[model samples]
Target chain A: MSIVKRVEANDSWYMPAIFKGLGITFKNMVLNLVGKREMITLNYPEEKYEYSPRFKGSHILTVKKDGSIRCTACMLCATYCPAECITIKAAESEDPTVEKFPISYEIDTLRCVYCGFCEEACPVDAVRMGPEWQMPGINGANFVYDIKQLARRPQLKGGIVSVVDEEERHKAGI
Target chain B: MVSLKQSLKSFLQKLDNKSRSIYFLTQGCCSIEVDNLCSSNYDLQRLGYTIDIDDPREATVLIVSGWINPAFAEKIKEVYSQISGDKAVIAVGACSISKSPYVDENGLKLTDVLPVDIYVPGCPPRPEAIIEAIRLLEKTKENRETSKIIYGAIRELG
Candidate 1:
């Protein structure tokens, strides 16, 4: 005999759960539709949520005290990049103390996975992930990044902890 | 009167549909290429060029997106060969230009290896520069041929 599905009283089962979820969702939908609550999406260009000081966004090659690229042509970032996106040609500098500089340093933005491992691999704090996140372009070639472009990036005077949304930062202990 | 309006609609439709087609090929290490080329504000089309996925022999632009490996070299060569005679090839990123990293299986010097018509330099180039590159190509060459070729390439990420 086929056991007619035994419906338990305690279990209003799937329908009740679905309705409960629908009710919450419906309430949220109305709330969002009417802007009953404050907005969450940043105004973007006008306003952006704060990110970590170490937030991996744009790449910046920091300079030494002498205003030279901190990279010793170590080839660490180039090797570590899974995308194989970095290009560098090392040259011996005339100043023996400085040693080496990338005669040329280039990154094909089209192919970069943006993993930021290159920044991590650098022994010297030469290349770092900066807070400037806006990066967009067309066709792969236009995305190739240059050293000058990476270096001249505006320093986010907004301190590292400065980016975390004040409200969210209050929520987070860090 | 109906026919005139209909004709005007079709003409307007064609004018609105006018878009440039660009195919990107990856040969070098690719980083930030899309960030530098296709973001909203710096949309390359704003510079009067569109990126399309159609065949290059007729589409007019072919962008080699990354570094060129010997294995992939044959395919890149074929793609260039298949593009229309007036079409141009652009190497967009550094990986496509030089095998900066250690080359075991997935790297090669593309700029030195292939005949690139233009080089858009960047780890990922700025979108503005990318737009500039497209405009430069348009000014430099006129699309003369009109045939389409479709045969090799399009393999999985190796």
Candidate 2:
């Protein structure tokens, strides 16, 4: 009775609060055991994971039929990023329809958060994150991944348009 | 830590006692220097000098790869200041030395202030050339440091 009075005097909620604390650690402990290997890594390159149709991984500056970057240099991705980690320079293309091709487009992978905002910000569907997420470099500068590196090497599957003609028909819209 | 210079010199000694510790900075223009540093064929890190982020107190050499954006210019200055004495900054690529027409084409106006110790000229300089530059940086022991312009033959991207 004295304990109850003391509890009321303090105006503290105890049972649920104490149980909630135990439940939090219990959930994390269970997850720790279940996700030990997963915590260490993703089995990339060998076994790539599928992202949502809306998921963003790594940005690839895509090429048209004539083998040119499709980016018009609109600066949409650069403008939208919360981190301001992307850099691109636009140039007029021989094909007027493709007004600007990125004369210089590079991303500091060291600083990029891998948010799909760049992918969504792109109006021309030229830049999207296909599944190549593993950029292992000892130097932070090496982490500055370029457009050519991103585009020439598409490590995952099924995007706007496949660089390989054989897979072109299987592109997202087509 | 002995003097900052001495600590870095010791670090380079660990790579190959004969080699000098280099402060490699590869961000905007010099980013490819990182690629050349890591490519399986080039693998400059295997040669034994570590390349870190903007931190240069641990290093005595700086390699500017790309054009520094306005935002990063101050960071570069801060990095340059943190580096210990008797340091060297290697300006790499056309962008680092002279603003490449290609660089400005994209809306990036970068001014690489002069007095660079070594100028490595190329759109994207080859890894072999970078190795050669490392060798040069290691060999120059003059007390009166001077900016040296180095050029190589045109090469393939690979």
Q: Give me the candidate number with maximum DockQ.
A: 1
lDDT of 2 by residue, B11-125 (tens): 5434333224566656653575556565554555566666544457767777777765556666667777888755666766545544442323432322344246555544455
Q: What RMSD does model 1 have? A: 13.6
Candidate 2 interface CA RMSD, Å: 13.8
Against the true structure, what is model 2's DockQ? 0.04
TM-score to native of every candidate shown: 0.42, 0.35
Query: lDDT score of model 2?
Result: 0.57
lDDT of 1 at B130: 53
Provide DockQ values for all models, in the order shown. Answer: 0.07, 0.04
lDDT of 1 by residue, A147-169 (tens): 67776544633222212232353
Error of 1 at B111 (Å): 16
Model 2 chain A: worst 10 consecutive residues (lDDT sum): A132-141
lDDT, residue A86, candidate 2: 84
